[model samples]
Target: MCGAVKFEVHGDFDSFYLCHCRYCQKDTGSAHAANLFSQSARLVWLAGEEAVASFTLPGTRHQKCFCRTCGSAVPNTHIPGLLVVPAGCLDSELSRVPTAHLFTSSRAAWDHALGDVPEFSGLPKAT
Candidate 1:
Protein backbone atom coordinates (compact mmCIF):
# COMPACT_ATOMS: atom_id res chain seq x y z
CA MET A 1 0.00 0.00 0.00
CA CYS A 2 1.09 3.56 -0.64
CA GLY A 3 1.55 6.22 2.00
CA ALA A 4 -1.65 7.91 3.13
CA VAL A 5 -2.76 11.36 1.94
CA LYS A 6 -6.33 11.92 2.96
CA PHE A 7 -8.90 14.27 1.40
CA GLU A 8 -12.66 14.62 0.96
CA VAL A 9 -14.61 15.06 -2.29
CA HIS A 10 -16.54 18.33 -2.11
CA GLY A 11 -18.47 17.93 -5.35
CA ASP A 12 -19.10 15.04 -7.68
CA PHE A 13 -16.16 14.52 -10.00
CA ASP A 14 -16.53 17.00 -12.85
CA SER A 15 -14.60 14.62 -15.03
CA PHE A 16 -11.69 12.20 -15.02
CA TYR A 17 -8.95 13.06 -17.46
CA LEU A 18 -6.23 10.95 -19.00
CA CYS A 19 -3.55 13.41 -20.03
CA HIS A 20 -1.10 12.51 -22.76
CA CYS A 21 0.19 16.07 -22.76
CA ARG A 22 3.92 16.55 -22.46
CA TYR A 23 3.51 18.21 -19.09
CA CYS A 24 1.80 15.10 -17.70
CA GLN A 25 4.49 12.90 -19.17
CA LYS A 26 7.26 14.93 -17.53
CA ASP A 27 5.40 15.39 -14.30
CA THR A 28 4.70 11.67 -13.89
CA GLY A 29 7.98 10.56 -15.36
CA SER A 30 6.04 8.30 -17.64
CA ALA A 31 4.19 8.23 -20.94
CA HIS A 32 1.01 9.75 -19.60
CA ALA A 33 -1.13 10.09 -16.45
CA ALA A 34 -4.70 9.68 -15.25
CA ASN A 35 -6.30 12.38 -13.12
CA LEU A 36 -9.52 12.94 -11.25
CA PHE A 37 -10.73 16.53 -11.69
CA SER A 38 -13.17 17.71 -9.09
CA GLN A 39 -14.30 20.91 -7.49
CA SER A 40 -11.77 22.58 -5.19
CA ALA A 41 -14.32 22.57 -2.39
CA ARG A 42 -14.31 18.78 -2.43
CA LEU A 43 -10.72 18.16 -1.38
CA VAL A 44 -8.98 18.38 2.01
CA TRP A 45 -5.52 17.11 2.94
CA LEU A 46 -5.63 15.31 6.24
CA ALA A 47 -1.91 14.59 6.62
CA GLY A 48 1.55 14.43 5.06
CA GLU A 49 1.48 17.92 3.58
CA GLU A 50 5.05 18.40 4.82
CA ALA A 51 6.38 15.54 2.71
CA VAL A 52 4.89 16.96 -0.47
CA ALA A 53 7.05 18.90 -2.90
CA SER A 54 5.78 20.74 -5.94
CA PHE A 55 7.19 22.34 -9.06
CA THR A 56 5.59 24.82 -11.42
CA LEU A 57 6.35 24.58 -15.10
CA PRO A 58 7.69 27.58 -17.03
CA GLY A 59 4.55 28.56 -18.96
CA THR A 60 1.75 26.73 -17.22
CA ARG A 61 -0.35 27.32 -14.14
CA HIS A 62 -0.40 23.64 -13.25
CA GLN A 63 1.79 22.60 -10.33
CA LYS A 64 2.68 18.98 -9.71
CA CYS A 65 3.65 17.49 -6.34
CA PHE A 66 5.16 14.24 -5.15
CA CYS A 67 6.40 12.67 -1.96
CA ARG A 68 9.98 13.58 -1.20
CA THR A 69 10.35 10.37 0.82
CA CYS A 70 9.13 7.73 -1.65
CA GLY A 71 9.08 9.75 -4.85
CA SER A 72 5.46 8.89 -5.45
CA ALA A 73 3.46 11.73 -6.96
CA VAL A 74 1.05 13.23 -4.47
CA PRO A 75 -2.25 15.00 -5.12
CA ASN A 76 -2.01 18.76 -5.66
CA THR A 77 -4.66 21.27 -6.63
CA HIS A 78 -5.50 23.28 -9.70
CA ILE A 79 -8.00 25.24 -7.70
CA PRO A 80 -9.33 24.66 -4.18
CA GLY A 81 -10.85 21.28 -3.14
CA LEU A 82 -9.84 19.93 -6.53
CA LEU A 83 -7.21 17.24 -5.96
CA VAL A 84 -5.16 15.68 -8.73
CA VAL A 85 -4.00 12.30 -7.39
CA PRO A 86 -1.87 10.15 -9.60
CA ALA A 87 -3.85 7.07 -10.64
CA GLY A 88 -1.00 4.81 -9.53
CA CYS A 89 -1.02 6.34 -6.08
CA LEU A 90 -4.43 4.87 -5.44
CA ASP A 91 -5.07 1.30 -4.35
CA SER A 92 -6.22 -1.23 -6.94
CA GLU A 93 -9.87 -0.46 -6.38
CA LEU A 94 -9.58 3.25 -7.02
CA SER A 95 -7.00 3.04 -9.79
CA ARG A 96 -9.33 1.01 -11.98
CA VAL A 97 -12.07 3.60 -11.93
CA PRO A 98 -11.03 6.31 -14.36
CA THR A 99 -13.67 8.67 -15.74
CA ALA A 100 -12.08 9.70 -19.01
CA HIS A 101 -8.93 10.36 -21.00
CA LEU A 102 -7.77 13.77 -22.14
CA PHE A 103 -5.14 14.79 -24.68
CA THR A 104 -5.46 11.51 -26.52
CA SER A 105 -3.98 13.04 -29.64
CA SER A 106 -0.63 13.30 -27.92
CA ARG A 107 -0.57 9.79 -26.50
CA ALA A 108 2.36 7.56 -27.21
CA ALA A 109 2.00 5.04 -30.02
CA TRP A 110 2.96 2.06 -27.90
CA ASP A 111 0.67 2.83 -25.04
CA HIS A 112 -2.40 0.63 -24.78
CA ALA A 113 -5.10 2.54 -26.56
CA LEU A 114 -7.99 2.66 -24.13
CA GLY A 115 -10.80 2.21 -26.62
CA ASP A 116 -13.45 1.56 -24.04
CA VAL A 117 -12.92 4.63 -21.89
CA PRO A 118 -14.18 8.00 -23.03
CA GLU A 119 -11.31 9.55 -24.96
CA PHE A 120 -10.85 13.05 -26.27
CA SER A 121 -8.17 14.56 -28.42
CA GLY A 122 -8.22 17.33 -25.84
CA LEU A 123 -10.31 17.78 -22.74
CA PRO A 124 -13.64 16.04 -23.19
CA LYS A 125 -16.77 18.03 -23.94
CA ALA A 126 -17.81 19.65 -20.69
CA THR A 127 -19.85 17.18 -18.67
Candidate 2:
Protein backbone atom coordinates (compact mmCIF):
# COMPACT_ATOMS: atom_id res chain seq x y z
CA MET A 1 0.00 0.00 0.00
CA CYS A 2 0.97 3.66 -0.41
CA GLY A 3 0.92 4.21 3.39
CA ALA A 4 -1.16 7.28 2.76
CA VAL A 5 -4.26 5.58 4.10
CA LYS A 6 -4.40 3.34 7.15
CA PHE A 7 -7.34 1.81 8.96
CA GLU A 8 -8.50 -0.97 11.27
CA VAL A 9 -11.52 -3.27 11.29
CA HIS A 10 -12.65 -3.62 14.92
CA GLY A 11 -15.38 -6.28 14.67
CA ASP A 12 -15.64 -9.63 12.95
CA PHE A 13 -16.48 -9.93 9.29
CA ASP A 14 -19.59 -12.00 8.54
CA SER A 15 -19.08 -12.91 4.90
CA PHE A 16 -16.44 -13.02 2.20
CA TYR A 17 -16.82 -13.33 -1.55
CA LEU A 18 -14.77 -13.21 -4.72
CA CYS A 19 -16.92 -11.28 -7.11
CA HIS A 20 -16.38 -11.79 -10.83
CA CYS A 21 -18.87 -9.25 -12.03
CA ARG A 22 -17.78 -6.82 -14.74
CA TYR A 23 -17.73 -3.88 -12.38
CA CYS A 24 -15.58 -5.69 -9.87
CA GLN A 25 -13.20 -6.92 -12.56
CA LYS A 26 -12.84 -3.41 -13.91
CA ASP A 27 -12.26 -1.85 -10.53
CA THR A 28 -9.70 -4.43 -9.49
CA GLY A 29 -8.17 -4.80 -12.95
CA SER A 30 -8.28 -8.52 -12.37
CA ALA A 31 -10.47 -11.56 -12.84
CA HIS A 32 -12.30 -11.08 -9.56
CA ALA A 33 -12.54 -8.95 -6.48
CA ALA A 34 -12.06 -10.40 -3.00
CA ASN A 35 -14.27 -8.58 -0.54
CA LEU A 36 -15.12 -8.99 3.12
CA PHE A 37 -18.52 -7.93 4.31
CA SER A 38 -19.40 -6.80 7.81
CA GLN A 39 -22.45 -5.39 9.42
CA SER A 40 -20.80 -3.99 12.50
CA ALA A 41 -17.11 -3.48 11.78
CA ARG A 42 -15.85 0.02 12.39
CA LEU A 43 -13.49 1.86 10.02
CA VAL A 44 -11.18 4.37 11.66
CA TRP A 45 -8.80 6.17 9.35
CA LEU A 46 -5.41 6.74 10.99
CA ALA A 47 -3.96 9.06 8.33
CA GLY A 48 -4.31 10.68 4.92
CA GLU A 49 -8.04 11.10 5.15
CA GLU A 50 -7.65 13.90 2.68
CA ALA A 51 -6.00 11.61 0.14
CA VAL A 52 -8.79 9.04 0.26
CA ALA A 53 -11.37 9.20 -2.48
CA SER A 54 -14.52 7.12 -3.01
CA PHE A 55 -16.57 6.50 -6.10
CA THR A 56 -20.00 4.93 -6.27
CA LEU A 57 -20.53 3.23 -9.64
CA PRO A 58 -22.69 5.88 -11.28
CA GLY A 59 -26.13 4.27 -11.08
CA THR A 60 -25.40 1.33 -8.85
CA ARG A 61 -24.60 0.57 -5.24
CA HIS A 62 -21.18 -0.79 -6.18
CA GLN A 63 -18.60 1.53 -4.68
CA LYS A 64 -14.83 1.74 -4.32
CA CYS A 65 -12.49 3.81 -2.16
CA PHE A 66 -8.82 4.29 -2.94
CA CYS A 67 -5.84 6.41 -2.05
CA ARG A 68 -5.12 9.01 -4.68
CA THR A 69 -1.41 8.79 -4.01
CA CYS A 70 -0.84 5.19 -5.07
CA GLY A 71 -4.34 4.15 -6.09
CA SER A 72 -4.52 1.48 -3.44
CA ALA A 73 -7.83 0.29 -2.12
CA VAL A 74 -8.87 1.44 1.36
CA PRO A 75 -11.64 0.56 3.78
CA ASN A 76 -14.82 2.53 3.28
CA THR A 77 -18.37 2.71 4.55
CA HIS A 78 -20.66 1.07 2.03
CA ILE A 79 -24.00 2.02 3.47
CA PRO A 80 -25.72 2.63 6.75
CA GLY A 81 -24.62 -0.17 9.10
CA LEU A 82 -22.46 -1.90 6.50
CA LEU A 83 -18.82 -1.90 5.51
CA VAL A 84 -16.96 -3.46 2.60
CA VAL A 85 -13.28 -4.23 2.84
CA PRO A 86 -11.08 -5.29 -0.03
CA ALA A 87 -9.15 -8.30 1.24
CA GLY A 88 -5.97 -7.22 -0.51
CA CYS A 89 -5.81 -3.98 1.49
CA LEU A 90 -5.46 -5.60 4.87
CA ASP A 91 -2.05 -5.27 6.49
CA SER A 92 -2.81 -8.16 8.85
CA GLU A 93 -4.10 -11.66 8.34
CA LEU A 94 -7.77 -12.42 7.88
CA SER A 95 -9.58 -14.44 10.55
CA ARG A 96 -11.21 -16.61 7.90
CA VAL A 97 -11.11 -17.29 4.18
CA PRO A 98 -13.25 -16.36 1.23
CA THR A 99 -16.67 -18.00 1.40
CA ALA A 100 -17.54 -18.24 -2.32
CA HIS A 101 -17.15 -17.00 -5.87
CA LEU A 102 -19.99 -14.89 -7.11
CA PHE A 103 -21.22 -14.11 -10.63
CA THR A 104 -19.20 -16.84 -12.21
CA SER A 105 -21.15 -16.53 -15.42
CA SER A 106 -19.60 -13.16 -16.05
CA ARG A 107 -16.04 -14.22 -15.32
CA ALA A 108 -13.47 -13.67 -18.02
CA ALA A 109 -12.66 -16.58 -20.31
CA TRP A 110 -8.92 -16.31 -19.65
CA ASP A 111 -9.51 -16.66 -15.95
CA HIS A 112 -10.80 -20.19 -16.27
CA ALA A 113 -7.38 -21.66 -17.18
CA LEU A 114 -5.32 -19.80 -14.59
CA GLY A 115 -4.97 -22.65 -12.14
CA ASP A 116 -3.57 -24.96 -14.79
CA VAL A 117 -0.68 -22.63 -15.60
CA PRO A 118 2.82 -23.14 -14.26
CA GLU A 119 3.63 -21.68 -10.88
CA PHE A 120 6.66 -19.63 -9.95
CA SER A 121 8.01 -18.36 -6.67
CA GLY A 122 8.48 -14.99 -8.27
CA LEU A 123 8.30 -13.51 -11.73
CA PRO A 124 9.75 -15.99 -14.25
CA LYS A 125 12.94 -14.98 -16.00
CA ALA A 126 12.69 -13.90 -19.62
CA THR A 127 13.23 -16.61 -22.19
Candidate 3:
Protein backbone atom coordinates (compact mmCIF):
# COMPACT_ATOMS: atom_id res chain seq x y z
CA MET A 1 0.00 0.00 0.00
CA CYS A 2 1.15 3.53 -0.69
CA GLY A 3 1.98 5.70 2.30
CA ALA A 4 0.59 8.92 0.86
CA VAL A 5 -2.69 8.43 2.68
CA LYS A 6 -3.49 6.60 5.90
CA PHE A 7 -6.83 5.04 6.73
CA GLU A 8 -8.63 3.32 9.56
CA VAL A 9 -11.92 1.43 9.73
CA HIS A 10 -14.31 2.81 12.31
CA GLY A 11 -17.03 0.21 11.84
CA ASP A 12 -17.62 -3.26 10.53
CA PHE A 13 -17.78 -3.55 6.76
CA ASP A 14 -21.19 -4.05 5.20
CA SER A 15 -19.49 -6.16 2.58
CA PHE A 16 -16.31 -6.54 0.61
CA TYR A 17 -16.45 -7.13 -3.13
CA LEU A 18 -14.21 -7.75 -6.06
CA CYS A 19 -15.65 -5.70 -8.89
CA HIS A 20 -15.08 -6.51 -12.52
CA CYS A 21 -17.19 -3.65 -13.80
CA ARG A 22 -15.77 -1.84 -16.82
CA TYR A 23 -15.64 1.42 -14.88
CA CYS A 24 -13.57 -0.18 -12.13
CA GLN A 25 -11.25 -1.79 -14.63
CA LYS A 26 -10.58 1.56 -16.27
CA ASP A 27 -10.21 3.45 -13.02
CA THR A 28 -7.77 0.92 -11.60
CA GLY A 29 -5.99 0.22 -14.88
CA SER A 30 -6.22 -3.40 -13.87
CA ALA A 31 -8.24 -6.49 -14.66
CA HIS A 32 -10.37 -6.02 -11.55
CA ALA A 33 -10.54 -4.19 -8.24
CA ALA A 34 -11.45 -5.15 -4.67
CA ASN A 35 -13.53 -2.72 -2.66
CA LEU A 36 -14.65 -2.56 0.95
CA PHE A 37 -17.98 -0.89 1.63
CA SER A 38 -18.79 0.59 4.99
CA GLN A 39 -20.04 3.75 6.60
CA SER A 40 -17.89 6.80 5.76
CA ALA A 41 -16.91 7.12 9.39
CA ARG A 42 -14.97 3.92 8.93
CA LEU A 43 -12.52 5.82 6.80
CA VAL A 44 -10.04 8.14 8.45
CA TRP A 45 -7.78 9.99 6.07
CA LEU A 46 -4.72 10.81 8.09
CA ALA A 47 -3.08 12.63 5.21
CA GLY A 48 -3.29 13.77 1.59
CA GLU A 49 -6.94 14.74 1.13
CA GLU A 50 -5.75 17.93 -0.57
CA ALA A 51 -3.91 15.85 -3.14
CA VAL A 52 -6.91 13.77 -4.07
CA ALA A 53 -8.17 13.94 -7.64
CA SER A 54 -11.53 12.71 -8.83
CA PHE A 55 -13.30 11.85 -12.07
CA THR A 56 -16.88 10.87 -12.74
CA LEU A 57 -17.73 8.71 -15.68
CA PRO A 58 -20.54 9.91 -17.89
CA GLY A 59 -23.94 8.22 -17.48
CA THR A 60 -23.07 6.40 -14.27
CA ARG A 61 -22.41 6.81 -10.55
CA HIS A 62 -18.96 5.43 -11.13
CA GLN A 63 -16.96 8.23 -9.60
CA LYS A 64 -13.35 7.55 -8.61
CA CYS A 65 -10.75 9.53 -6.70
CA PHE A 66 -7.05 8.96 -6.25
CA CYS A 67 -3.97 10.46 -4.68
CA ARG A 68 -2.15 12.63 -7.18
CA THR A 69 1.31 12.05 -5.74
CA CYS A 70 1.31 8.27 -5.62
CA GLY A 71 -1.58 7.56 -8.01
CA SER A 72 -3.22 5.35 -5.42
CA ALA A 73 -7.01 5.25 -5.39
CA VAL A 74 -8.69 6.78 -2.33
CA PRO A 75 -12.09 6.32 -0.77
CA ASN A 76 -14.95 8.48 -2.00
CA THR A 77 -17.85 9.27 0.28
CA HIS A 78 -21.20 8.09 -1.03
CA ILE A 79 -23.26 9.50 1.79
CA PRO A 80 -22.61 11.56 4.92
CA GLY A 81 -21.14 8.49 6.60
CA LEU A 82 -20.82 5.87 3.91
CA LEU A 83 -17.70 5.14 1.90
CA VAL A 84 -16.21 2.72 -0.57
CA VAL A 85 -12.50 2.13 -0.19
CA PRO A 86 -10.22 0.20 -2.49
CA ALA A 87 -8.83 -2.87 -0.67
CA GLY A 88 -5.48 -2.35 -2.32
CA CYS A 89 -4.85 0.67 -0.13
CA LEU A 90 -5.12 -0.95 3.27
CA ASP A 91 -2.01 -0.98 5.47
CA SER A 92 -3.21 -3.62 7.87
CA GLU A 93 -3.51 -7.33 7.20
CA LEU A 94 -6.53 -8.08 4.95
CA SER A 95 -6.61 -11.85 4.95
CA ARG A 96 -9.41 -12.19 7.47
CA VAL A 97 -11.88 -10.41 5.22
CA PRO A 98 -13.83 -12.40 2.66
CA THR A 99 -14.74 -10.74 -0.63
CA ALA A 100 -17.55 -11.69 -2.98
CA HIS A 101 -17.01 -11.03 -6.65
CA LEU A 102 -19.47 -8.77 -8.47
CA PHE A 103 -20.09 -8.05 -12.15
CA THR A 104 -18.52 -11.32 -13.14
CA SER A 105 -20.11 -11.18 -16.58
CA SER A 106 -18.10 -8.06 -17.33
CA ARG A 107 -14.81 -9.55 -16.20
CA ALA A 108 -12.08 -9.81 -18.78
CA ALA A 109 -11.74 -13.22 -20.36
CA TRP A 110 -8.06 -13.22 -19.60
CA ASP A 111 -8.70 -12.91 -15.88
CA HIS A 112 -9.47 -16.18 -14.17
CA ALA A 113 -12.20 -16.48 -11.59
CA LEU A 114 -11.28 -16.39 -7.92
CA GLY A 115 -11.54 -19.73 -6.16
CA ASP A 116 -14.67 -20.49 -4.06
CA VAL A 117 -15.96 -16.95 -3.63
CA PRO A 118 -19.57 -16.28 -4.63
CA GLU A 119 -19.93 -14.51 -7.96
CA PHE A 120 -22.74 -12.24 -9.11
CA SER A 121 -23.66 -10.95 -12.54
CA GLY A 122 -24.38 -7.62 -10.94
CA LEU A 123 -24.53 -5.97 -7.54
CA PRO A 124 -26.42 -8.10 -5.03
CA LYS A 125 -29.99 -7.09 -4.40
CA ALA A 126 -29.24 -6.63 -0.71
CA THR A 127 -26.36 -4.28 -1.32
Candidate 4:
Protein backbone atom coordinates (compact mmCIF):
# COMPACT_ATOMS: atom_id res chain seq x y z
CA MET A 1 0.00 0.00 0.00
CA CYS A 2 3.08 2.21 -0.29
CA GLY A 3 2.84 3.03 3.42
CA ALA A 4 2.54 6.68 2.62
CA VAL A 5 -0.08 7.29 5.22
CA LYS A 6 0.00 6.16 8.83
CA PHE A 7 -2.75 6.49 11.39
CA GLU A 8 -4.10 4.91 14.52
CA VAL A 9 -7.50 3.93 15.83
CA HIS A 10 -7.47 4.70 19.51
CA GLY A 11 -10.47 2.66 20.62
CA ASP A 12 -12.03 -0.71 20.06
CA PHE A 13 -14.05 -1.26 16.93
CA ASP A 14 -17.80 -1.58 17.29
CA SER A 15 -18.33 -3.95 14.40
CA PHE A 16 -16.72 -5.55 11.43
CA TYR A 17 -18.48 -6.32 8.19
CA LEU A 18 -17.63 -7.89 4.89
CA CYS A 19 -19.59 -5.69 2.56
CA HIS A 20 -20.77 -7.13 -0.77
CA CYS A 21 -22.52 -4.10 -2.15
CA ARG A 22 -21.87 -3.38 -5.82
CA TYR A 23 -20.26 -0.07 -4.99
CA CYS A 24 -17.95 -1.84 -2.57
CA GLN A 25 -17.07 -4.52 -5.13
CA LYS A 26 -16.32 -1.95 -7.81
CA ASP A 27 -14.20 0.22 -5.54
CA THR A 28 -12.27 -2.71 -4.12
CA GLY A 29 -12.13 -4.59 -7.44
CA SER A 30 -13.03 -7.68 -5.48
CA ALA A 31 -15.90 -9.72 -4.11
CA HIS A 32 -16.28 -7.68 -0.97
CA ALA A 33 -14.80 -5.02 1.31
CA ALA A 34 -13.81 -6.03 4.81
CA ASN A 35 -14.35 -3.01 7.00
CA LEU A 36 -14.21 -2.19 10.67
CA PHE A 37 -16.70 0.30 11.99
CA SER A 38 -16.45 2.40 15.11
CA GLN A 39 -18.43 5.28 16.43
CA SER A 40 -16.22 6.25 19.36
CA ALA A 41 -12.64 5.66 18.20
CA ARG A 42 -10.51 8.63 17.34
CA LEU A 43 -8.48 8.60 14.13
CA VAL A 44 -5.09 10.24 14.45
CA TRP A 45 -2.85 10.65 11.48
CA LEU A 46 0.72 9.71 12.20
CA ALA A 47 2.33 10.52 8.87
CA GLY A 48 1.60 11.68 5.35
CA GLU A 49 -1.77 13.00 6.33
CA GLU A 50 -1.45 15.39 3.44
CA ALA A 51 -1.54 12.43 1.09
CA VAL A 52 -4.94 11.28 2.24
CA ALA A 53 -7.85 11.89 -0.10
CA SER A 54 -11.48 10.95 -0.39
CA PHE A 55 -14.17 10.49 -2.99
CA THR A 56 -17.89 10.26 -2.42
CA LEU A 57 -20.27 8.68 -4.88
CA PRO A 58 -22.73 11.25 -6.12
CA GLY A 59 -26.05 11.26 -4.30
CA THR A 60 -25.09 8.26 -2.24
CA ARG A 61 -23.70 7.67 1.23
CA HIS A 62 -20.86 5.66 -0.27
CA GLN A 63 -17.39 7.07 0.20
CA LYS A 64 -13.81 5.87 -0.11
CA CYS A 65 -10.69 7.24 1.50
CA PHE A 66 -7.25 6.48 0.10
CA CYS A 67 -3.67 7.43 -0.15
CA ARG A 68 -3.34 9.59 -3.21
CA THR A 69 0.18 8.35 -3.87
CA CYS A 70 -0.67 4.64 -3.67
CA GLY A 71 -4.45 4.64 -4.18
CA SER A 72 -4.80 2.11 -1.39
CA ALA A 73 -8.03 2.31 0.54
CA VAL A 74 -7.80 4.09 3.93
CA PRO A 75 -9.98 5.05 6.86
CA ASN A 76 -12.96 7.27 6.29
CA THR A 77 -14.78 9.52 8.77
CA HIS A 78 -16.73 11.74 6.48
CA ILE A 79 -19.87 10.15 7.79
CA PRO A 80 -20.88 11.75 11.04
CA GLY A 81 -20.24 9.80 14.24
CA LEU A 82 -18.74 6.82 12.44
CA LEU A 83 -15.32 5.83 11.25
CA VAL A 84 -14.91 3.17 8.58
CA VAL A 85 -11.56 1.46 8.30
CA PRO A 86 -10.50 -0.97 5.64
CA ALA A 87 -9.29 -4.04 7.51
CA GLY A 88 -6.69 -4.86 4.89
CA CYS A 89 -4.83 -1.61 5.43
CA LEU A 90 -4.04 -2.24 9.04
CA ASP A 91 -0.41 -3.01 9.72
CA SER A 92 -1.15 -5.11 12.78
CA GLU A 93 -3.40 -8.07 13.43
CA LEU A 94 -6.80 -7.66 15.08
CA SER A 95 -8.57 -9.84 17.62
CA ARG A 96 -12.01 -8.81 16.43
CA VAL A 97 -13.72 -10.89 13.76
CA PRO A 98 -16.13 -9.97 11.02
CA THR A 99 -19.64 -9.77 12.39
CA ALA A 100 -21.44 -10.47 9.11
CA HIS A 101 -21.48 -10.25 5.37
CA LEU A 102 -23.67 -7.36 4.33
CA PHE A 103 -25.47 -7.01 1.02
CA THR A 104 -24.99 -10.68 0.19
CA SER A 105 -27.57 -10.39 -2.56
CA SER A 106 -24.96 -8.45 -4.51
CA ARG A 107 -22.17 -10.92 -3.90
CA ALA A 108 -20.54 -12.10 -7.09
CA ALA A 109 -21.44 -15.58 -8.19
CA TRP A 110 -17.78 -16.53 -8.64
CA ASP A 111 -17.07 -15.59 -5.01
CA HIS A 112 -19.06 -18.50 -3.67
CA ALA A 113 -17.30 -21.35 -1.91
CA LEU A 114 -13.86 -19.91 -2.53
CA GLY A 115 -12.37 -21.96 0.30
CA ASP A 116 -12.55 -24.97 -1.99
CA VAL A 117 -10.09 -23.38 -4.41
CA PRO A 118 -6.43 -24.32 -4.45
CA GLU A 119 -4.29 -22.65 -1.80
CA PHE A 120 -0.97 -20.97 -2.49
CA SER A 121 1.91 -19.95 -0.33
CA GLY A 122 2.89 -17.31 -2.80
CA LEU A 123 1.26 -17.20 -6.21
CA PRO A 124 2.04 -20.92 -6.72
CA LYS A 125 5.68 -20.00 -7.32
CA ALA A 126 4.70 -18.33 -10.60
CA THR A 127 4.21 -21.63 -12.46
Tens digits of per-residue lDDT for model 1, 77-126: 75565666666665535634666767888877767756777666987776
Count of clashing residue pairs in every prediction: 6, 0, 3, 0
Candidate 4 Cα misplacement greater than 4 A, ranges:
none
Better of 1 and 4 by TM-score: 4
Task: Please identify which of the two predictions, 1 or 4, would achieve the higher lDDT against the true structure.
Answer: 4
> Candidate 2 — which residues are off by over 4 angstroms?
none
- Residue range 1-127, candidate 4, lDDT tens digits: 8988999989989999999999999999999999999999999999988999999999998999999999999999789999999999999998888999999999999999888899877766654
Question: In terms of TM-score, which candidate is strongest?
Answer: 4
lDDT for model 4: 0.94
lDDT of each: 0.68, 0.89, 0.77, 0.94
Looking at model 3, the pairs that clash are: 10-42, 40-81, 40-82
lDDT of 1 at 121: 92
lDDT of 2 by residue, 60-115 (tens): 98889999999998877857888988999999977797899999999998998677
What TM-score does candidate 4 reach? 0.96
Question: lDDT of candidate 3 vs native?
Answer: 0.77
In the order shown, the candidates' Cα RMSDs to the true structure are 9.6, 1.2, 9.6, 1.0
lDDT for residue 95 in candidate 4, whole number 0-100: 85
| C-alpha RMSD between model 1 and the true structure | 9.6
Compute each candidate's TM-score over C-alphas: 0.68, 0.93, 0.77, 0.96
Better of 2 and 3 by TM-score: 2
